[model samples]
Each structure stands twice: as structure tokens, then as C-alpha cells.
Target: MNNNTPNNNLTIESLWQFSLQYYSMREIKEACLNLQNHFHGNVNLLLALKWLDEHRLTFPSSQWPQVIQSLGRTEALLLHFRELRRKSKQHLPESLYRDSLQFELQLERQQQADIIDIIHRIELSKVEAPHLVDDYCHQLGAEHLAVIFNKQRL
Candidate 1:
């Protein structure tokens, strides 16, 4: 997880880039959105977990309190807009649905940045990707963790 590690090329910009590339994969966007809709799983956190797994970084569950605290404002804003988008999707015109969803997408990006900032501020343990994935799924309370973790096309 150290910057000096061979795979330690992580920066905020790179993290965001990785998120876009990863989410663009077939079915990944669907899985992430499903997790977000059903489990209250933050897509940003899920993306961060993927990045951390790539970089061999492990974050314990104990660190989540601080991470959650750090994300308070951004998460709240995202949630508010996401709910609006959901409602608009159900009741509003199709044209308005796109706008609302776009706004929520921007908020999700902002929350991703907030998440990467928190990850940068915290200490990371060096562990195998399997261990990191297990830790991340456990912390997220992902009942269907295998589907998301193993659904990668690679």
C-alpha cells in the first residue's frame, strides 16, 4: 500500500479514472447500482474497495466510523439527490428523469472524491487481494458479495 510499492500508482485522479473504467465494464454498473439501491452500499466506497484491492491495501472495519464521519456531508447530499432521482423516475416525465439522474451521478462522483480523500488520510494495511476483498465485503455487509467481487470480466 505504500507509494513505493510496484503497484502503488494510486492518486486521486487515478482513482477516479479507475472508477470510470471499472464501472464501465459489462454488468458492473448494474451490480453497483443494485448494491446502492438495495443495500445502502455507497458506490464510491465500492469503487474505492476495488481500487484498494488493486493496490493491495486493506482497511479494517474499525476505520469505517472515521470514514463515515468524514463522508457525512457528501453522503447526505448524494442520498438526498438519489432519492429525488428515484422518485422522479417513478412519477415524473421521462425528460426530467434523465436530469435528476444526471444530478445524482454528479453527486456520486463527488462522494467518490470524498471517499478517496478519506482513504488517503487513513492508514492502510498491506495484504493479499483476497484478504482485502474479504475485509471489504465483510465491512460492507454484502450478503451477495461473491456476485459483485467475482462478476468482474477479467
Candidate 2:
């Protein structure tokens, strides 16, 4: 867990790429959605944590609140569209639903960018990667997801 890598590779675009590749997996995608739907967890934040874990970097604990706050607006919008997409499935045409889903994905990417911005502003330390993700999942009473995430790590 203490395998810290150089931070040279850490970037806004890198995080988005990591998230896309990671979330495309069926198991990780389902686990993330489970945490989001049942535990009020932010999937972007979860992915950010995982990305940080992969990079062997983590920000200070004090910055956690700010990190959460950064995505508030976007998270709300995501949830709204998620609900709309779910509820409108019966009435909306498939094309419209696909558009809505695509927009939601865009919002998700924006959220990852926002997260990386916050992380960039904070002082990060080299530490065991799983600690932050573990703490967050435990805080949400979803330790199972922490396990899932760790197991799914590349």
C-alpha cells in the first residue's frame, strides 16, 4: 500500500481517462452505483479516491469537506438527471433517454475534473492508497465497496 509513485502523471485528463477505463468494468460500475444509490455516496468522489489510490497519493483529511463541497452543484444536477432518466424511461423515446444519459456522463466527467482541481490545490502526501477509500466507504457504511474497489484495482 505504501508504493508511492511520482506525481508527474497526475493530471485532470489522466484522472478522467482512469475513471473511464475503470468504470467501464461491469463489476466496478455496479458496485459504484450500489454505493451511490443506497449509501448516498458520490460516484465521482469514489472514482477520484480510487484514482488517487492508483497514483499512490492522497490529500489531507482536513480538505475532505472542501472536496465534497466542490462537487455539490454537479452532484445535484447528476442526481436530477438520473431521476429524470429513470422516471422518463417509460414515456421518453430511446433517443432522448440516450441523450440524457450522455449528458449525465458529461456531468460525471466534469465532476472528476472538479475533484482533480481541488486535489491539485491541496497538499498531497504519499501514503497507503486504500486508507482514504476505506475510510470513506466505512463512513458511508459501505465497507463492501471499499473491498470491491481494492479487489478491482489494476
User: Against the correct fold, how does model 2 do in TM-score?
Assistant: 0.90
Q: lDDT for model 1, please.
A: 0.70
Colliding pairs, model 1: none
TM-score of each: 0.77, 0.90
Residue lDDT tens for model 2, 46-129: 988888887677777887898888897688788888998899999988999888889888988888878877776777778754
- Candidate 1 TM-score over all chains jointly: 0.77
Q: Positional deviation of 20 in candidate 1, in angstroms?
A: 1.5
Give lDDT tens digits, candidate 1, residues 1-154: 3464443455767878888898898688887877777767777877777777766677667777867776686888778777767666778988888788777777777777777777776777777644544455566677576467655733
Worst 10 residues of 2 by lDDT: 1-10
